[model samples]
Target: MKIKPNKLRSISIVKGQLKNVKFCIGDDPIPTVSEQPVKSLGRWYNASLRDKDQVQQVRQDITNSLENINRTLLPGKLWRLQFGLLPRVMWPLTIYKLPITTVEKLERTMTSCMKKWLDIPRCLTNISLYGKGVLELPITSLTEEYKFSKIRLQMTLKDSRDQTISNAEQPIPSRPQPSSERDRKSPTYALCPTPATLKHILTGCKTSLTQGRYTWRYNQVLKSLAAALESERNSTNSLPLRATNSITAPTFIREGQKKPNHPPTKPETGQLAMARDWKMLVDIGQQLIFPPEIAATTLRPDLVLWSPSLKSVYITELTVP
Candidate 1:
């Protein structure tokens, strides 16, 4: 095939330009132009030839797959990710040493998709925290699954190879050492952030979900109490603060329900409601044997209960903000 001048292109893998360089056919130099991330052979080629563009493309494709995969077919989706999507990623991974951050992000995305496929939250993946039979299989982050897959692949290849002269045929790549004379830092190893085993994954997921729910409920209760205080103040408007703490107990009732006496004859409904809500929480604590601990100092709590069952202590302070 005869190639025209406009059809030729070049990519320099080095920092400098490919100046004065040319490809020729019988002394006729072919013109060249520079471009990044040229695509060929179903992969992206870049100036550095590092395959970063290909990796990025693969990552985006994987994300798109996660978004469009059939939600109704749970098992089918699992199989697709495990058998199909994984192999696609492995092809690029084999050629390029991907950054740890990129790998982490991809793993997180996979874990999220897996959770959605199972119709469960992340916490449910760890079965140890929530007990058994909650999930059919333990959910693991993509990185762990990838590592496990790689190991299995390595084992299979090893088993198929002839053992006697295989070592002689390929020299084992030695791990690189630090160049500095200072003591080299020893490597640290840790399990993937998410649980790997099926049992533990379910338990962990449930535990995490439960804790999240608890935190949410706790916040709701706090907001309710705050709102109650605001509403009650507008309704009663006669709740008195300590003499040393405020503008001398509102000289002549600013607004709302009128007080009949100058010396504060009756307790306001808002104050009563505030006390009631606080008491309700206290009663709950008492029932659980984890009552609030009251300090013995003057002007302290009206009610305090102590529980030896839990080593944690809680204190409630009420204010009419």
Candidate 2:
């Protein structure tokens, strides 16, 4: 084997041992050995052998990357962070030893950047950002990713692989019967008459339904949608339809040919522009009564938008499920 002295560097793992270490290539003394950290495999290792510096470096890199991403002012920042920044962050987490606290801090920083990208208030809970919420978004949780990565790494180890094979070869065991009274008890809620399973809590709890819990949640969502529609209804930017008798200019003509017999038809503006007297009603604190002249229906919708001049009515029913 051949050696390149200039490309080589060394570091002692034991404290106070670097002073006694020396290297030479055929008595041409190689003086690269020191207590300072040496770069190896894209990571820094020092005499102490602690991962503090490496972790700090990784943290700094992540912070800088997030800052740079935030400054770009580009769309789909969430996607960029998820696909671009998170993978790079996960690489170090999987390769290097990092404490949960460090991962949490990094996640907090990332979460802050995500809030900016999403244009949401910081007061929003982290669970709402990563977990199932009223407004579900595609966001990854760093701590969960770290845990999964660790599990994946463990699965690749020789012991784990051997154990997995051994388990697969063994006969399947029968399902265990309830051994204790507590285990045999059917789960139930104080207010709910039925079993307190996830499905019951989410949809089938008669007590919750009668208490208006479902109605409150439905109204909350409907309120936001109605507010947005109200703004659009009041806006004056809607394109008005061209008069039927008005003539439109020709859009195009061939270089050496005469204009066509008929002019290109103007795109139809929606019925919304027909009249500006737009009125909106929402079923919130009070019950919504369907206009008698429009339908005289017993069923009430969440929202109603109508224009008397155009005789147009828009009924919207909001469903959370």
TM-score of each: 0.36, 0.45
Instruction: Give me the displacement of residue 279 in model 2, in angstroms.
Output: 81
112-153, model 1: which lDDT tens digit per residue? Answer: 677776687777543432234655453335566556666665
Residue 96 accuracy (lDDT) in model 2: 86
Q: What does candidate 2's lDDT look like per residue over 120-143, in tens digits?
A: 999898988888768877788999
User: How much is 214 displaced in model 2, in angstroms?
Assistant: 53
- Model 1, TM vs. native: 0.36
lDDT of model number 1: 0.51
Candidate 1 clash figure, as a count = 22
Candidate 1 RMSD to the real structure: 17.6
The alpha-carbon deviation from the true structure for residue 265 of candidate 2, after best TM-score superposition, in angstroms, is: 99
Best by lDDT: 2
